[model samples]
Target: MASPACAATVSGAPFAAMDFPLQPRRPTPGQRALAEALARGEAMMGEGIEQLPAATYTDPDRFAAEMRLFRTLPQLVAPSALLPEAVSAVAHDGYGSPLLLTRGADGRAHVLANACRHRGTRLVDGDEVVGAKRIVCPYHAWAYKPDGELSGMPRAECFPGFDRSANGLRAYPSAEIGGLLFYAEDEQADFSDLRALEPDFDAFGMAGLHLYERRVHDVAANWKLIVDAFLESYHVQRLHAQTIAHFFADGITVADRVGPHQRAAVGRAALLERADLDDMASLRRAVTFTYALFPASIVVVSPDYINLLVCMPQSVGRTLVEDYMLIPEPPQTNEAAAHWQKSWALLDGGAFGTEDFGAAARCYRGLASGTIETVTLGTLENGIADFHRRIDAALAR
Candidate 1:
């Protein structure tokens, strides 16, 4: 039998029964004190903000502050460029969120919340062929049109005064830029427009790309920690010595903060080099640019593909990282798919899921130990400092 429709209206409160990973564990007095101290310490680039002391990493209080920052800030989800046709929409539940991407009959993309407006059941399951037309919920037979309006219900007359016009799938705000889609929970966010970063996207050549393969991982670390790993290449030599070290500069990295909203850092060489494809007609010419759309999303551009990282905080210490690899649209072939899969596995296995996270995991353990007093920010990694400051300021509001 189909599950019953939920009672809450989409706009008023689909979140009534939703259990988001928003709450942090209770903190002790010492932890609270330490968090306050760290927040109060001014984080200027060349001043006392040199390196986070070992004590900061080990303190329970500092961890609390990190959680506070994540919960308060408005996170960046997608770029405006990717929304030309909304392909799919993702939703947040108590555990993790769901993403729904679709290509409509009109050859347009539309993304909407993955949760059914009724009873909160997931509307779309897996990556199956949804095709064109309305989305029918497998649970209670409720259906919604592509534009997120109510279409049908199993038994319309069972309940009197049923008003389909008053209820539709709740949609979070979405935008795109540089061929990337962006979603945000805050409807009032002004930074949703990517035209502000036109020069950056043009320089990266992200306009002509096509969405290809995407990989999602439930990473066991704070979202900020995952983000910090990508802002600088300082540890590339030490941590990723064998896997990705050959393609990156171990010591020299450039970090720049454009404003409160974005930070970017470039390595000497692109990580995913495909020099053998000189004759291949569709190869994107640029490689090796790493940029972060402050608060969450990170993008890596290579000659063959562009890797976009979208992260969401799952708990005080856990995060979900979505890694998307976009390549030039090519005929669907087994060999091409296999090659792309191998490329994605290689990057996720070595750079992020392993070495990068290995370092951050240690940092987490140290933070809980109360041994590290504060985190030190490198001058070259000024972006890191700016990120910390922005978090502090946003949470303060």
Candidate 2:
């Protein structure tokens, strides 16, 4: 049977009990700092103004440097919600190379090249999540198990000596943590930093959530430019004036760091007057949290659902973004479906697709004209500065 629908918004409250499947967890020490600052009507600020050269977005050499950073590190594959069960596979082409994401009888997901080992033909054909119980190569009829173990060949005696164990699909070094998948071409890269996000992920209960919908956006702007749009709330009142501005207090977003990642809490002044700060559910309703994952990924926790985006650079002037909408569970009724559909249309269409990305594209065009040499970040926009610094440090290493 379908799970019951999430309760409608109750009273004047921002959160409804049935929207979240897991028990609310207390904010982490770092996250608590964000909440405390929100409760005080203050936000974290930079010591001074920080400026980034326009070349960071328009220069070919600089863009290559940024791409190098991705090559040397593990890239986030996809949110775990996309493949929530065993015997599943998805064709993911957002991260540059074509990759087949599979989960076998082992009940764990693995990242594999989309090519068949025998004749190098594509194994997976579409973007739909499919059961990878057994993949038959459309080119040569060579079959493989979900784990990439070769299972059959058209004519067994055709090849003089064939070692099935030695002829499997190429697999990347990967791990699933915090409902996110991280994989790398290098076999020895460290994932301890990614592992450290467990406490935060546990609080969000991301692992078991249902994937409601997903869209791939091809934007005409530099990837960092798009990422910069989310690291600050300074533009919401103006850029999103018609959509989400009324939901926030002006000049009020507190940011904290978790290793290389960033945590930001949007101020909702109502929380300052509440006496139940100790109640996590109430606190969650009082403020919205956003995570700026290192490199370029974002998680925005709404009152009832989550918006997760992964940004990948396609060129100095272009980017490809994979956007996913996650909910506690699939909507079980027409009313529930309408509610989520409305939420998706508002966020994916108005707030993000049109406002946020539009701003990035406009900024990219101006920077490319060679008129502005530097982009400046003010005290309120310090999170963007901090993020760029981390990027520089990682590239230097």
Candidate 3:
């Protein structure tokens, strides 16, 4: 259902609420458990404490294994809304592999190497979206359709074999669902597990949302540390005291995962007052949901919009984060633009950039410096615990 006003409360602090019409999403059984748990006022408890070696984050061998694991798994690219037209193309470089994301007349999204089949030249360059029907190689003018089907070359018979049908661009597996795009570096990557996310994405009306703004943060931290910062709320109260600390109930986040991906939610004190599940107003004010799309991406359902973050690792101590802010619709007035602009500023530069990521970078310094032998996670950080378990399994494979 459409969200009502959003509110945040802090002890000895003034209460606050924000009114914005967010796209509606159905409440699932997971969310039901979240509400009930809040009503019970229970502290977060898990299987107890877990300790992981600091080398897990700083070892060169481990970093190579992690990179291998990430490539084999599917990664969230961007909202399909960014390339809604049947014939469209966008160049993306944040996924470690330079890619040309295209939607053909068949309405299926395709993720292909940005390099042209000839001389491995980049067929498309830059970040702007292209609506051309054929991708022409900048070097030789060899043209191919959006589906990567080779159409013609400067000389039809000059090349060996001269077979256009088998000379298309190299491609990886890709899919489009609920307005989002996903691809894997492995062509045989199985995507059945991703079906679990469609219902949630549909509820958010993600397919129809507008792309408000996008920013990239290349920070000094291991990529997993960035994800770790978001997998729990233990730091929300203290780390975000001046920003969003008053907005949520401390230490009460509920989490569950599908395959390696996790869906989690944290509620506010007002959550106890929300008696009806269908009451969108109280529900919006009381709970906020976060989706940890494994390997690389995170989608946060905020009070009025959604934030999608894709974290790509460059080395044992560096990461690049691409953040996209999605809204219900395009801003039609200056006031509306200002509304999203203000939200973007606070989140991009303030909450995520300075607080969460900043902390991750500092932790990386300590871990890499060999000051800590192991990273200790308490029961409250069950989500982070689960995160490491998934990684361990992948690397072991």
Candidate 4:
């Protein structure tokens, strides 16, 4: 499972191998209540429904509290399609936390702190330094290997007890599933048991997948705001009327595990049972399966490829989203690449791109003002509400 270098480093190593605590097979009391509320369409439904307190999404103190929660809480951030070749990690410094990603020649993933251990410099700037074994710090000449090992430091003699063996870069606890890698940065948090959220590569159909395209979004909103927008299809009939409304339905169903991870299903029977899809064989491609992996990642899978949306907080009011379009396997020819590109462009240029971002930005600005005190989430938006509730609970702990 490991290359020669990785094997040698890990073999009989003193470092405690990451052991995730096994979550119970059954859902907790909170899960049962939330599930029941979603089933009955009560928690987030009806006129004059008390909105989720706006302070949760707007106030600076609230934002800071949430940030600390995400950074320290024992929540699982779901894996992505590139889990084999890329282990995405998120960490915080004085300014803000950045998502760091890395992969080895052997296809193992490792998410580490983006900053250099020595001088606090970002080791990864963008997606350019991917698939490389050597990562040389841009600020200083401090160099390190892919597995978080320091092969050389300029002045080794000056720093006493500076054991290169003990100075490997910090590695957040991460595990891969169905082509995605899930991780948490809490050092004392136990994550050895992951049965609560079993590996669902087959259920998600992520095996043998390949990268298609990456969409980098500098969204001007809180990460949760964007995630909340993506969690529901209630807006499909109205907000997305110009684009994806025709393909999606007005209703939704949701299911959750012990962790923050949850799955939302949208009815595609309209397309399957309707005669309008008679000519489109691909429409039988199965219903829309949207998985919100734990903390801050959403994996949207269709018949053709998987679209992954990852939200990383930039500031109290801003977020950096890295969106990727992935296919089952690499394209074999120019025609295939062209076909993928066309689909990507249509999705991005059309509703999923502009409409989603545009509406989310407006919502954030409105929240920023004191006018709105609460945001009401509907039954179809249960997934979104559940996410917020889960976040609040985790942070409250």
Candidate 5:
């Protein structure tokens, strides 16, 4: 489908375009829960304090369970905008397996195993492959079509009874929605958890947005800890006081869950003075919407751009984070470029890297000390509790 058109502003200049309309003013059921929970001064608590045991972060068995949850369940792999054209492909290594995402000749995206079926050789080595008609295995010179079909073999006549069709690359079960690509190792894995966020996904124009920049961080903490840090605003005043503390209201947040995914918005200090709380779109302008897609993806929507943080677990105490900054469009002029550059410097460089992840590293040291039996989540930190509950549920199943 064609993208939505950009409207004109009062001065006749083109307004920044978005694929979907602004979110409605009426509160969704989840939003209402958030409002009520805030009024009660209670954060959404999980089953019990035992839900977050220290071993959940440091134990090998728990880490293995978490890894199984990641591989067997549907997880966000890449944004649709990353493969905008035919013959485009990107390699990902976050899901405990090497994955190759390719846009085929028909312009449909596909997720395939990166290993060649011929001799189990890696077809593409780097993070992305663009404008390639076929994936050629470096070891055997076997080539496969972008859709994972076996196309050519080096010595076909050597094996008279060889069946090329049976040697095609293995493909993972994948789905594209709201401009994002999700895949799971288990072909029968259910994706209703992700599909339930269609309304919020569309409202944010996730699919139509362009990826502006990306940064990778190797954090010294469990993946869950990093997820917890982003979903709450309780630490903003103390941790980010020098950077973004003044911009946001302290200790005030609203959160609601859409199936396995959860979203939380912390009020901006500038808008706290306004009496009206009914206009959702206006409120969105004043707050940052943090959507934690179960398993490990967190998409943070600010007024100007979107930040996609993928927490990829590497070991019990190490996680690789890929942070992507997506904008409505590429900057056309020097002024626009400078503005986006400054935005990246503040959000990704200053606030996230320096403050958030830095704190996570220190927190990991304490958790690994073996003194604390369990960590606690406050009422305002309900998102963290909800996340742990989802993890336990997924592992149980």
Candidate 6:
């Protein structure tokens, strides 16, 4: 049986749940300061003449710097649930390199460079490999253990002084925290800073959630531009009016920063009339929370599911975005499955992919035309401002 919160509906609507199981924990000092700032109407006023030069979005040099920042900083790659069992591996191509994530026989998660040690050929191209004891390069048949150690080569005698132990797959620094898998090019990169950004992350039960579907979209826009689309609700009333506008209050968003990361919430208009606004449960049901993890990942939480968007830069003018929809569990009945499918079709296909990202592409072309010198952000769009500030800080390092 479903939990009452899960089964609850808004005035008899099938997919309209009035309450969500996950509630925001008590705000930290930084979060409290942000709340007080919002209450004082400070966050609603424009931050005065802020300008992100148009060249930053179209210059090849700036794009390369951004990619360098990504490689240096720790990034959330996938949810831990992707590799559910030992010998299970998943291939991801969004990052700078092809990545292979596997659960070793020892029950530990590993992130390995997917390229073969010899000839640098990708070992797998498909999304997933199940019950695999070893990974064999399709080109030269070089084999590797589940733990990423080189196990065999086609003919060992051909090369003199060839050491198998020294030829293992390159492993990136990684950790599974709050059910998310994070990796960085720096083998000694510290994830403590990233983990501190969302201390209550585990309370959301993200580890237990299962990936429902994954979609990859190639957008003709700068990666930062794609991320900017999700940082604010200012465009929803206009761009997403046909889809999600009716569900949220226009321009009523609150943003809080945790180090370089940000959490923004958009209130639902339907909940304003509720008598239980003081309660955490009721409050959670009345808003949508979006977390912009520093760099290029956005995690949006709704009552019934979570959407993760990861933007990967292909060039100054091109980006590849991987969108994953995650649900608490797999649907056990046809009715449940159908409901999720319809919900996904409306949210992912209509609002997110088509309306949001599609508009981003057009925005990029305009920026590239050099007609505008700077993109302005209003007080309501402080989340976007914060996002750009973080990028500037990262690149400055």
Estimate, for each residue in 1-397, the C-alpha lDDT of model 2 and write its tens digit.
Answer: 0000011121135533245444566666766666777677776667788899988889999898888777767778788989887888988777778798988887788999899988789998888998778888999899888888889988979987889889988888889987878887777877887788877776777787889999988899999988888887677768877876666666567776777877777746665467255555566666677877788888887767788888988999999988898888889888788888887887787788888888899999999999999998877677777777888898888
Per-residue lDDT tens digits for candidate 5, residues 49-89, read 33477887889788987898887888888788888788877
What does candidate 3's lDDT look like per residue over 143-178, in tens digits? 988998888799777886767788899888888876
Alpha-carbon runs more than 4 Å astray in model 3: 1-25, 279-282
- Specify the highest-TM-score model's number: 2
Candidate 6, superposed: residue stretches over 4 Å from native: 1-15, 18-45, 154-161, 268-283
Q: Supply every candidate's count of residue pairs whose N, Cα or C atoms clash at under 3 angstroms.
A: 51, 0, 2, 11, 2, 0
Instruction: List ranges where model 2 is wrong by over 4 Å.
Output: 1-22, 272-280
What digit string (tens of lDDT, one per residue) describes model 4 on residues 1-397? Answer: 0000000001112112122121222333433333343334422222332358877767788777777756664333333544444423223232244546566556676666777888888876644435446777788767777767777787778778877788777787766655565566667655543444444434344555676777667777777877776566567668766655555434433344545666543433333343122221122142344666656667665546667777777777787766677765666777667767766765565555677767778888898887888887655565566677788787778
TM-score of each: 0.70, 0.92, 0.91, 0.74, 0.85, 0.86
The better candidate by TM-score, 4 or 5, is: 5
Better of 2 and 6 by TM-score: 2
TM match of model 4 to true structure: 0.74
Flag regions of model 5 displaced more than 4 Å.
1-51, 268-283
The weakest ten consecutive residues by lDDT in model 6 span 1-10
Ranking by lDDT: 2, 3, 5, 6, 4, 1
Give the lDDT of residue 100 in candidate 2. Answer: 89
Q: Write the number of the candidate with greater TM-score, choosing between 1 and 2.
A: 2
Per-residue lDDT of 1-397 in model 1, one digit per residue for the tens? 0000101111111111122121122322322222232223312233333564553334346656655443333444543333334333333331244655544445444446777887888887654334436787888989887667788988888868978887787765555455555545556655433446555564444655556655567766666777777765556656766666655333343333445545332222221132122211111221244557767777775545567778766665666777666655542677667766665666766666676666777777666566656776655455555566676676677
Question: Could you give candidate 6's per-residue lDDT for residues 212-247 as a string of tens digits?
Answer: 888889999998887887776667768866766666
Q: Give residue 298's error in model 4 in angstroms.
A: 1.1
Clashing pairs in 5: 43-379, 179-207
Misplaced by over 4 Å in model 4 are: 1-50, 73-95, 98-100, 115-124, 137-142, 154-161, 190-198, 252-258, 270-284
Whole-model alpha-carbon lDDT for candidate 4: 0.56
Considering TM-score, where higher is better, how would the candidates rank from best to worst?
2, 3, 6, 5, 4, 1
Query: By summed lDDT, which 10 consecutive residues of candidate 1 come out lowest?
Result: 1-10
| Alpha-carbon shift of residue 395 in model 1 (angstroms) | 1.4
User: So what's the TM-score on candidate 3?
Assistant: 0.91
